[model samples]
Target: MNKSVPANVTIVDHPLVQVKLTQMRRKETISSDFRRLLKEISLLLAYEVTRDLALTEREIETPIERAMFPVLRDREPCFISILRAGNGILDGMMDLLPSARVGHVGLYRDHETLEAVEYYYKVPSDIADREVIVVDPMLATGHTAVAAIERLKKDGAKNLKFLCLLAAPEGIAEFHKGHPDVPVFTASVDKKLNEHGYIVPGLGDAGDRIYGTK
Candidate 1:
């Protein structure tokens, strides 16, 4: 619908993310290692994503002396993992920001219509007051991801971010067209979507790979 996605959308090209992404893409990678690498890469990506988070000074006593130290503002960020595939990224982001609250949103794309249909949705206590990040592995077509963000906005989340391991240009455009105010952070943007809607030269079905299913 809309073609204007944020030019600022970062495709984290860090060498470590690239290396881990390569491992995740291999067909031989087992669920255990897949999950582990996803977690590690997610954490690394989170580090870059949170670089601009607001911080405040707080008085703390170190082993040596008492001084004011910069800490994440008293505010706690909230994370929403789009079910199944998103959970892999969730593990990593959680490991990085243990203090952040968590939520889950589940949606299934209809086999025939290819339309997103929500199955489950749950969020933190007061999402309006906190920064919210939605994690999903692939941003293809952007139908489900955009729908997810619409639900989050309806629920009161003012600040939002979308995190994905890989994204296609078409999907990214669709997403930003709908929510231009929100920013997306992703590991890499592959070439283009094939006729079947899979990203070309892209990692295969993320949900299947992460959970060890077909």
Candidate 2:
């Protein structure tokens, strides 16, 4: 919410987003509740991320009379999820853009090196022609986000945005250094990442919290 935020980042600090983020951050929050809150907060984040979507007028007949309605210029935007954790945000993003085409990129951070290793990736053939939104719940070390974006770019993606639930300053810096053209949207920018590369004051491992795997 601060006007001093970097030009490339938009923090959705709305009351509802903040309230839900608080609930999600608690260690006592159950997996079910955490998952639900992530989805809710993601929906709110989506509203801001898509604020500049292009629209065109279309004539449609209402019950009373015909009228022009504004519809997305491109009916389908590309939604790419950065693996298992990103799937959580993808679910909520889809709720907002049900018709958007979906893509998946699977990458995991190496515990020792904190580097992202890609295992799987598939995207729409027309990704170059559509605006792409990359979803990942936590942007901690940022290797994964950077790697994912690079892969997308290599595959012809041009217009791109990155969305995450929580971000670390280290991660944001690294991300921008690699892809300054892409904008980032997040619910909260936490203090910092610990030595192990986890965001301090972050809601633990987002994938673990959402899936109860840890």
Candidate 3:
């Protein structure tokens, strides 16, 4: 983990995660492979992000006997993906949390100011009452993340976590500055953002690669 990254930020550094990330970063990786890798990595990332979820004991009867089993105390957590690219991660996350409610926050960054402008936003009606995890493959400039978090907060979401496959130090800093209470999870925090505000060495525009737009 980079010392400069906020304490709240967690880097999932498992060997599998690293290998998958490396494969995804290669320019030659096809859209199908890229999408598959993203989903695989997102499931790995989901495990770490949901580690602290509250659990409760439940009385259940097994085939042989009755016993108390531990189960999630709350209803399934809500997942909010940040538009087009976020959908890639959402699929993997759902693999782990099949019952979780899903939401989408559509935002596009203004190339000139590097600010996020929201074009769409929607979430579960009970969003305010459940744990909410925001998923995006890359956290580059962080403006889009900050904007998305702000919107979630405004809509009464209190418990929030941001998850990404890769993050830039600049984005992490900006994110923490805007929403200090929200923790961030990522597979890797790369060197830094470039002049154009993209994470250096990041798996290029996640949406483009995942959907073969480029």
lDDT of each model, Cα atoms only?
0.87, 0.91, 0.93
Candidate 2 lDDT by residue in tens digits, 110-199: 998999999999999999999999999999988999999999999999999999998998899999999999999998888888988999
**lDDT comparing candidate 3 with the true structure:** 0.93
TM-score against native, each model: 0.94, 0.97, 0.98
**lDDT tens string, model 1, 1-214?**
1233368687787999999999988888988998899999999989888878999999999999999999988478898999979999988888888999999999977767667899999898799999999999999878889999999999999889999998989888889889988899988887788877787778888998888888
Q: What is candidate 3's lDDT per residue for 99-178, written digit by digit as tens?
A: 99999999999999999999998899999999999999989999999999999999999999999999999998899989
What total of clashing residue pairs does each candidate reach? 0, 0, 0
Query: Cα RMSD to native, each candidate?
Result: 2.7, 1.4, 1.0
At residue 173, candidate 2 shows an lDDT of 90
- In angstroms, the error of model 1 at 74 is 3.8
Error of 3 at 40 (Å): 0.4
Flag the better candidate by TM-score, 1 or 2: 2
Ranking by TM-score: 3, 2, 1
* Candidate 1 RMSD computed on C-alpha atoms after optimal superposition onto the true structure: 2.7
Top candidate (lDDT)? 3
